[model samples]
Target: MKGLLVLLICMLTATSVFAGKADTVKLRQHLIAITGTSQPRNHQHTAALDEVATYIKKEFEKLQGQVQEQVYTVAGKEYRNIILSMGPADAPRLIVGAHYDVCGDQPGADDNASGVAGLLELARLLHNHRLPFRIDLVAYTLEEPPYFRTEHMGSYVHARSLKEQQAEVKGMISLEMIGNFKDEKGTQRYPLAPMKLFYGSRGNYIAVVQRFGNGSFGRSFLRNYKNNANIPVKSLRAPAFVTGVDFSDHLNYWHFGFDALMITDTSFYRNSNYHQPTDTIYTLDFRRMARVVDAVYTSILNL
Candidate 1:
């Protein structure tokens, strides 16, 4: 009995260490380094974005995965979306995406760098893992203002093309913001009133939000993530007309009739530094971010 107790304690200790390693400050520093470009406008951050994409591509390639670049021009400036493929090409595809662009003023650490970091980590974790379906890890270019909700939205372009070509996209998941959390109550807010009852005021839980027609996907994802992830999760599905309902890149896929949902930290609602210059890397909780990435990877593989 003593030996068994010792083994259990050791196992718990090892798990705690692994979790701590995943949440290191280095992940946040890496995000800040990438978003800290010379110029925020005029593709000034393009090179930085490319550097991140290159790193992700190389990591996948090292695992013998396939990588593709989808280059597109926006307002006379060039931007590229990096796509990494795992598993058979002919299998049904599930896209996991996050935009790498920042607004002109801020580094966009929590606005999106958090999401990008999560996506990159997810790619690394699932690179060589055998899965039943094809998974595409996409790093999109323009998901912020001037491009958001417009025809030039990178996700809009990609989803529209798929719709036009009749591409077989089973589903898509967008990681908008996943690195900020607060354990205190009343730290979290919502666009609607009734949501306060369903979710806690603490920002520790990851959110799986979808529109009315896409609630099933949100519910399923929440169930899968909650069952597999170490952290808490909350799901919200409302009509598209609800304010702040269509807030992320997932909105584009919904426009194309594809099953899609946004896996977010409820940007602006809980993130105090949503789009400000103060939204730096120091504000995120990378440990929680890593767990979210792990849950996303598991969910996609199972899908």
Candidate 2:
């Protein structure tokens, strides 16, 4: 029965890929809670920001991570970035981050609450695990307009500070809109027409996107991520002209010359509810989202 034993071992290995706190139900509840937070347009709400920041900080503490806040101000308004660290203090750290703010007044469930949920799930699964490098889970503020792409963005500030500290940064992984998925044909669109033929017209996969000349980082991570993932994952290396590649917090890391990639569902390319009041809990696929979180864990361990 040698063949039978081999098959059994293979099944067990696959099952272990998603073991522990990568629970889809729990992930759904977390996303729902985040989406329910207040979303105020045109103005940054310090109260809402503090509420999420506190929640993130406490969650990390429960996992025994040392939590820190990077507080700053823009135009006389205050903001904060919730930071948590695991592994050795002297090692070069790997970053896992997601922005928590919404665009204007939208519920922003898919735009980012989902990404934050993924980050939390990762923190939970990675507990007690040892790695060669440190891992930092960062919850950022103001990734959306009118602050997007500006130096005021929480990610930009964090990246700059890390550079100044001369912190050994391995790289940054930014999760953005990882909840939306589609199976029907013609559901996906691209900024460039030719991409449709190369990538396909179905919005049914998670994307690991890196800028040109950085294929080594994104491709390796994407390969490791897809190795154990049950869901579809597409990896791409393109220039900044390719829309959505630099759409999230990862762009800041790239600006600082750090190798970074975005893990996403393609955002507005697939989700019609993007940045709209209609973007809510019901529009996302929590199961697939959980799979993405698990993949991130697996990729980090493999890296």
Candidate 3:
């Protein structure tokens, strides 16, 4: 009995170590450094964008993974989307993306810096781990407005190229504004009156949102992530015409008939600092963000 107890303890400790939390401090610092400054529109912070991309590339290369850059010029301004691939590159691929750009004078910590933080952490967690299918981790630019719904959307460019080349993409997951959580009631809001009945008022749960036709993939992804992370998750499927439905970079992939979902905190619905200067790193819930990243890692592996 004593030996059996010791073995169980060891196993539990190993599991805990493997499922350790994402580095909140590192994530916070990354966001603070980028959005803390005035990354103005049309004059976007090119230096900061390059810095974050370099950091991601170095981290992935440290694990002996292959990293590539896809560069495109938008309105005479050059921008590059960083891509990191693990496992067999020729196999069916799952693309995970988050835009690393900010809009206006706001430090877009929750607006999108949080999403980038999650993406970087996800890449770190799955760095050395092998998977059955190829995973392409991307950091896109120009997800914010003025370019959001237009053809200038960075995701639109990337996804369109994939379609043009006939790349076999199995599915895509977009991480957007996923670092904030609140356990208090009356903290969450919805676009439609009926949605309030389906979801709770507390802002503690992560949301899996999709359009009407994409509900099946949304539910399946939500179920898998819920089972893996054991974290609170809220799901909603509605027509894209609804307000705040096409709020993330994922909407671009959906335009191309790809099965995609947005993992978010509902952005402006719950986060008070959505597009303001107050969207700093201090306001984010890093613990939950780490769990979400872990769940994503597991979901991709299973897919």
Predicted candidate 1 versus true structure: per-residue lDDT over 1-303, tens digit per residue: 999999999999988644433434546655865666665521456666677667656655666578888888876767777788888888877888988787677778887888877776777667657787788888787788777788777788788877997878878899998988999999999887677887868888888888877735556766788787878888777888877778888899999989888888898899999888888888988788888887886666555
Q: Write the per-residue lDDT of candidate 3 for residues 1-303, one digit (tens) a residue.
A: 999999999999888657744676777766665565434322266666677667666656766468888888777877778888887878878889998877777767777878887888888778767777788888887888678887677788889988897888877899999888999999999987667787978899888888888735566677788788757887777788889777888888888878888899999899988778787778988778877777887776566
Rank ordering of all candidates by lDDT, starting from the highest = 2, 3, 1
TM-score of every candidate relative to the true structure:
0.87, 0.92, 0.90
- Candidate 2 residue 71 Cα shift, in angstroms, is 0.5
Model 2 misplaced regions, further than 4 Å: 1-18, 38-43
lDDT of 3: 0.79
Ten consecutive residues with minimal summed lDDT in candidate 3? 34-43
- Which is superior by lDDT, 1 or 2? 2
The per-prediction tally of clashing pairs is 1, 0, 0
Please identify which of the two predictions, 1 or 2, would achieve the higher TM-score against the true structure.
2
RMSD from true fold, candidate 3: 2.8
Model 3 TM: 0.90
